[model samples]
Target: MSNQQPGWFPDPSDAKKMRWWDGNEWAVHVSRDGAVWEEPLVAKTIGLKRRSRWVWVLLALGLLVAVALLSPLVALVALVVLVTGIVGISKGSGTWLRLKSRRTAIGVTAGAALVFLMAGSVSAAMVPGETGAPTAVETAQSAEARSEATPRRTSTPTPTPVTTSREEVVTEVIPFERSTVEDANIARGETTISVSGQDGERTITYVVTVVDGVETGRELKSDVETVAPVTEVTTVGTYDAPPEPAPPAEPTCDSNYADACVPIASDVDCAWGSGNGPAYFDGVAKVVGRDIYGLDRDGDGLACER
Candidate 1:
């Protein structure tokens, strides 16, 4: 019958234990393995007999009678005592008395009813509306519930700013220039360096600004240190050339062929012939190659005509 009521019963998940059924649904509280009820730690194994409802009814009747006869103070004290006894018997003795015997269970419930009647008489003697406050335990539990329901607070973080700079080095070439000067001693179309040219050098430093690990701005910080340039001197050839020696005189044809030449036209002068006055030749073969005297009547290389 108690199991059929709107309360707890042995859990289906664990047959040896009890779980709370809060009238409409099962609650989170569950008993240990051998427990018969789910409740406060000290009373979890105790079972409240369904008949305990009769104890509360008896308490109410006793309180009514005491309030009508005795004062309100007496009635209030009696009310407190009755409520305490009912809770203890229902939670502590209910399961134990029932399991031992039905007779024992009935005896305990009747005894608690009688105690409530006796205390109700004394509480009814107190003044009306002057009942004592709730017990310390109930007040403490209320405070604990309020604390758990309240939310906690958190702090906000602040941001910090930063400044940064960077330095970098780079190099570049300075070109050297060539300079020319006239040199009459040098030959034309020829180049000679009176002084060799040299390239100039320089170095510079800069200050650069960076933000969040990235470059943002830059400026020159140091004056450029420069090496002065050495002026180059190159001699361009401007010398005039001496006139080429007069080409040698051409040789004369008379000098190259003097053996064949004749200044006097005498037949004796003919070197190829031996005759003198007539410049005669017995045969043309005898006058071969000696016509310088012009004594040949025909060009047969003969000296004279027949």
Candidate 2:
């Protein structure tokens, strides 16, 4: 649509290439190959000057066809494009009638726009929400309505209640896990080994079993994962201890000897001795049950014999 220079001229550097000047007394040319120049189309006629002018007709036709095939909503959009194309096609040139001011062209465009929009709206409104069937909301409403419309049937099918005996209900027996054993040199007395876990506590009543610090049986009341349930565990020992040698009859001095040689079972070499002792190394005797006592000092709870 633009050329500022005059007629065709050979580009000084190349004979095949060309430069042109517009006819409005500017320096330009009219040529594709300077060998045979093309006469420039005058800009006075809008459509004749540029390739874009031709596109409007094509665009308007395409839009018109689109409007016909699509729903009103989409058709409305195509219609706007078609009308705008029509105005642009006029090219603002004076026709057989008169030249149109840009403003007048714009107004004409807007008017055509309003008309098509109205047509599209009217058409879309008639379209149904779905395939004529009600939506979930509507279907629910209809079902409710039918329920109210029908008369109530007082007698209905009654389901028989089935009873199951304890033996019939297959029980899921829960297995117990023994936590890590926490053994240590325990003083001679009753010690509570923490029997934790829900199932452990529940089945862990009076008869809670502990085989080598492991729970063999228990009823867990809570989930096995949480809750601090106390478990009664009995750590039965392999050996037992007897009552302390009845406070040995008062140690007596040998009638002719300077001091009493009567044996005094002092807990030396035992945990009570803090390294300070008569230095006499002996053995240890571990007692387990209430009535059992042993004198085997090598951690072997036995009686009498060292």
Candidate 3:
């Protein structure tokens, strides 16, 4: 094995696996059946190994270069490694330390320090210098220079002229006229419409003045009757009726006669007795006063007695 070149060789601890040997030492990289993985070489004794200070210095330089070219995640990994190394050194023994080696502790601490230093250097390099940033006065001067480079022209707006226009408009309206007629058949003070009146239409023209889409004024241009107005006819009643004849007066008995209602006529006689008469009296008649009808022939006041 000492004379063999750096290559995959059979693992000493496990014959079924193959391990990688660098020029100086065995690497943690291993492979089996074409598959590759990492596994630290087991130490024969659980004792710490001694390493020269130069090894630690070289590892620190390598980590610094890696951190400078890689991302911040690499820096964080280095910090964890450094913390683990410190804790292991304080406890004098730690399960995390491979082979419990003091050399690994020193290498991790130095590498973490170098990584931080390189990260700070990279940050400082990316920052802009004071002279590189523009000041307020310089910015103003540059803007003035740009303004002077181009000449600006001022534009004036033209005023709009006020215009007027006239438009003719035609409108239609309904109109009607009413007139009365005398009718003999209708009674006086009682009128009735003989004919139904209808509405008529008239057309009118107007001239309007408009300025800038707005109406200013309008004037009557012409008016013409399109349809003649219909006249409304009204009938009035006028009738005079003749006076009615008075009813006949009731006949009354003469005051000169008593105990009988004698007929008031030019001549009267007893109902069944004999005498020329225009009227007759039933039963006998007695006269208390003058006998106007001559119903009593005796001179006594009481005539036709018994």
C-alpha TM-score for every candidate:
0.31, 0.19, 0.34
The alpha-carbon lDDT assigned to residue 205 of candidate 2 equals: 19
Clashes of each: 14, 24, 5
Query: On residues 127-225, what C-alpha lDDT tens digit does candidate 1 reach at each position?
Result: 346566543345334544554554534467765645598776655556678889888888988987888777776676788897767778899877564
- The TM-score obtained by model 1 is 0.31
> In candidate 3, which residue pairs get closer than 3 Å at backbone N, Cα or C atoms, i.e. clash?
186-237, 187-237, 187-238, 188-237, 188-238
Top model number, TM-score: 3
Q: Over the stretch 126-187, how does candidate 2's per-residue lDDT look in tens digits?
A: 66453563333353345446545646546787776443221111223344544433334444
What candidate 3 gets wrong by more than 4 Å, as runs, is 1-155, 159-168, 253-306
- Model 1: per-residue Cα lDDT at residue 273: 57
Q: What is the Cα-based lDDT of residue 70 in candidate 2? A: 58
For model 3, state the Cα shift of residue 81 in Å: 64
lDDT at position 210, candidate 3: 76
Find the 10 residues in a row with the least total lDDT in model 1: 253-262
89: Cα error in model 1, Å: 49
